[model samples]
Target chain A: MTAEFWNGTMAAAAAAKQARVQVNAAYPITPQTHTVEYLSRFVNDGELDARLCKVESEHSALSACAGAAAVGARAFTASCSQGLALMSEVMYFTSGMRFPVVMAVANRTLSVPVNIWADHQDTLVNRDAGWIQIYTQTVQEIYDLILLAFRIAEHEDVCLPALVAYDGFILSHASEPVHPLDQAAVDAFLPPPGSADRPLLDPARPLQFGEVLFPDWYPDFELKKHRALADSLGTIRKAFEEFEAASGRRYAPVDAFATDGAEMVIVGLGSMMKTARHTAEKLREDGVRVGTAALRVFRPFPAEDLLEAVGGCRTVLVLDRDIGYGTGGMVYPDVTRILYHEDHRPDVLNFIVGTGGKDITPATIERCVELARGGYRGRVEFWPDARGAEEGVPYTEEPAAP
Target chain B: MPNTHPESASASAGRKLHEIRLAGRGGQGVVTAGDLLGKAAVREGFWAQSIPTFGPERRGALSSATLRMGPEEILLKCSTAAPGVLLVLDPTIWTQFNVTAGLVEEAVLVFNTTEAPEEVEARLRGGALPYRLGVERCRICTVDATGIALAVLGRAITNTAMMGAFCGATGLLGLEPVEAVLAERFGKRASPNIEAARAARDAIRWRA
Candidate 1:
């Protein structure tokens, strides 16, 4: 089918619809509301035959999804920020129980200051929750990855929950072109419903999920979960390859661009990668050796691929939209640890940027490159050094129109 | 605030990117207008993205939307630093905000005003405007979009009319795509909006 204009939320909802999600349990939240709202519309119009549960809270939403998945039914849900935080308990429980539920997270900043803008802190906080996490850079990736999420999460080898996170408002509300897959294509890519050949809560076949575990076996269960997540990288790679074959759109754990013999590289995740890449291209046009790489898969933390993307460069400036407080940016340590053991490693600098929906424009990326090249030695420096002191606030007080 | 105008490398990058900023109050369909603009661009086979900068939800609060469209993929997800076009659905918005901030050279500034372009500029220069236009060079286009909207749609929602004036001013997009998208979106009630757009397009007054 020809491409239609779709926001990131619409793309995600369309993917869920195409995957034939058995049950959709979600609470309305900003940025994320449109995804579930679209799903509800699909249900109302009879376009998608699924149960759209109008849940009271994000906790109940994920609980309902867990319940549906426990019964051998495909389940889907979505939320962000406070909503994702509320679903934290079930986020762990769903993965621990191996429900293979799929979720969409419109990545937003956490509260306290009470902001409703894009950031990766929400997803990064739950990074170790035993769930597969994939970040998207575009509206198309939202559709492709959410579709691939189902295939990867439900794979026999990786029966864990998965979440696809995109920048809130950036991806959630922005409209772009998305070539949605046909029903036949989606059907061919994913296994048919109720074909989850795993332990199910079948009345005929008695089984127990999330049962109480004694200390004696709990550590082993934890180890198994860890091993399953690490091993899921293979499953993820395989899915990416198969998806490329089916849909002419190729994806990798780390999507790299112009890294060949580059001296400086900018690395980022989610929607900011495109801007970084664009700035890199512009820098290259002026004969500056620069490149960019997008970290697509976060949970598996594809260390090798990430290394390959920025290993050869003299400097790797990581633009992280979320901070880990005392530790620096969430992705900063991850990158440095990967490069620490290497004989030829680049100096990785982390710039805490675009937090609370600040604009991570091409100009911001350029400033980052300048800082990295200037030998500014800070492990994690807020790009402007002082917030609100870089350029004038990019907003105008649009008073009520008379 | 840092002078962080949305950076405009479009000209030097050798890309034909059209960045647009829309200014209006809440409930004026500013975001919807951006959507239609982007959709129309997509219809003509150009990549387009439109985003609304949503603040606290309240009717009549100041609201804004941004759009970027080009032959190639529009990668910059940040707000438009230097818009090539600025559409002000409310003439009074000039008195409150610098609606013309960070406009590109030879940019198109369209306004919905009953007064002539000279009057609008006089008011802007007479210290009534809260901020300077701060633009280097631009072509100003004036249209009574509110009047057209009221005459055609019986409302003061000037988004469609402003969009039409945009097309008329820049000629970047054909009226066909805009009309087609309006037809597809509004169904039977599309005619009034479409008529408003056409009338605004026909009635645009230009000042270089």
Candidate 2:
């Protein structure tokens, strides 16, 4: 196989082209603009036989995808932070309508200070948006998961939309060597758009969709959608297994590293897990039994697999890039609730870190491990209390002109 | 603190991880230099990653890119803080930025300047440069990359020339892979950049 250097955006666009997405509608946003730009280039070069929809706003982007998917077309879109916030309403509509529209979200922080940096706030805020959410740790995973997302979202058992998230700038802008899957392999692994046995809004059939249900009927439909999302875990695992067999790259919902009989395991998401895992290896050299468990799939929650990864450890240090105001962190509560009734539960500590695009250095992670090992517990704390202090790049103001 | 790199540190031998920071203005192709180096390293069967500093890059404003290359997969996704090599595309960058911040001891410095090592050191000594210990010990490689670019490409883009200097001074990457990467990226326009790189590589002056 020929390996090429591709950043996360190029990988996502390549996967979409390979998946044969017929309609792509997206609005331009920082970081995420590159994905759609690459797709447009593919379309212009006649490499991808797809129609690029030039939408004006993020809401219209998803609306256009929903329209295309309602009629048995494989539709795709990409967005981030504020753009995702704009598409929040359509996100719910697209999921509830069961259109199976797959979106690639370059996870970035929200505004107020108006920053464009990597964080999980954008995707984490959409945790309850009724879509299957997955996170990626590397550029290769970005490509693999995008292809897998199309298959899982289009699976007959799970006709729900999905979001493939990678850290905004960390993975999005960073270039790495990725051995791309062959087009024929991807074609064999993923079926065409209309191949699934689902109802399509054909002009000959004239079926109605997105009709408002009465109060009593609304609850049943909502419950069914929720169950379909929860039950889609089976479909996700099956797709992962098949993709692994076809490509020889193994993936799990909770990708664990060095978690065998460890005293402390750091739980994190996105690109920071790479640094955390490296730190764990270095700590192992220093006789510290620290491991890392990254949550690849966040929406279905993957509680059982997460527990299995960290159940044997003495302490679980949860790193959350997005804070939940008074509650501290978004992932910490879910982790605590999952281990609440387990027989072998580890002490969990939450650290609100990397908020507003702060760098999560190895030193920052090492500090967290030390705290957990030193019996610091039962409280959510902020890391690197002094900004940019963990990394010793001293700030020096330019001297006044002589 | 965890060891950033827990391997040996020899330029020509062993499985060592090299971290390089390319500092330049936005219009000077700093990010593209890192990109070419990374792609070349990957082509030579080494694990490589390069990322531009995240922000809105305005022309004439300060911009930088970081590159990491090793014999195995690189797990750290963050930018390199303690780089073993620093490439300065604009000599004026030394005034506005530290330029040598977090550099490892006895590191390598590649400059896009026409001055010799003595002249460059005299200038820095005259200025108020903080943390002079590491800067004093670093081995310096001087090449007029901008002059080479101007002479070869008729433009002020120094990325290709800087890439050549990096390959020449470090011997970490061969010229064949770098030429292949340039030909693939620039297509028919690759001839001038390749010429500029070859000139800069041969013209580099090194001092311990």
Model 2 bad stretches (over 4 Å): A385-402, B1-14, B122-127, B130-136
Q: Check candidate 2 and list the clashing pairs.
A: none
lDDT of 1: 0.85
Q: Lowest lDDT 10-mer window, candidate 1 chain A?
A: A393-402
lDDT of 1 by residue, A1-402 (tens): 446999989999999999999999999988799999899999999999999888899999999999999998999999999999999999999999999999999999999799999999999999999999999999999999999999999999999999999999888999999988889999999999779788999889899888999999989998999999988999999999999989999999998999989998778789999988889889999998999889899888898888887777899888889888777788887888888999997878888888888877777777778777878774354554334533542222222211
Q: To one decimal, what is the Cα RMSD in angstroms of model 2 from the true structure?
A: 4.6
Clashing pairs in 1: A391-B2, A391-B3, A392-B1, A392-B2, A392-B3, A392-B4, A393-B1, B6-B81
- Per-prediction interface RMSD in Å: 4.7, 6.0
Tens digits of per-residue lDDT, candidate 2, B1-208, equal 1111112243442287888989989888998889889999988888999988866779978888889899888998877778888888886776677777778876778888988966776666675665243455667768898899999999988999888888777777867889999999999999999998888888877653
Candidate 1 per-residue C-alpha lDDT over B1-208 given as tens digits, one digit per residue, 9 for 90 to 100: 1111133232332358788899888878899999998999898888899988877867677778889888788888877878888889886776787777677777777789988877777676676567766654566768899899989999999999888887776676768899999999999999999998888888987653
Worst 10 residues of 2 chain A by lDDT: A393-402
Chain B of candidate 1 achieves a TM-score of 0.90
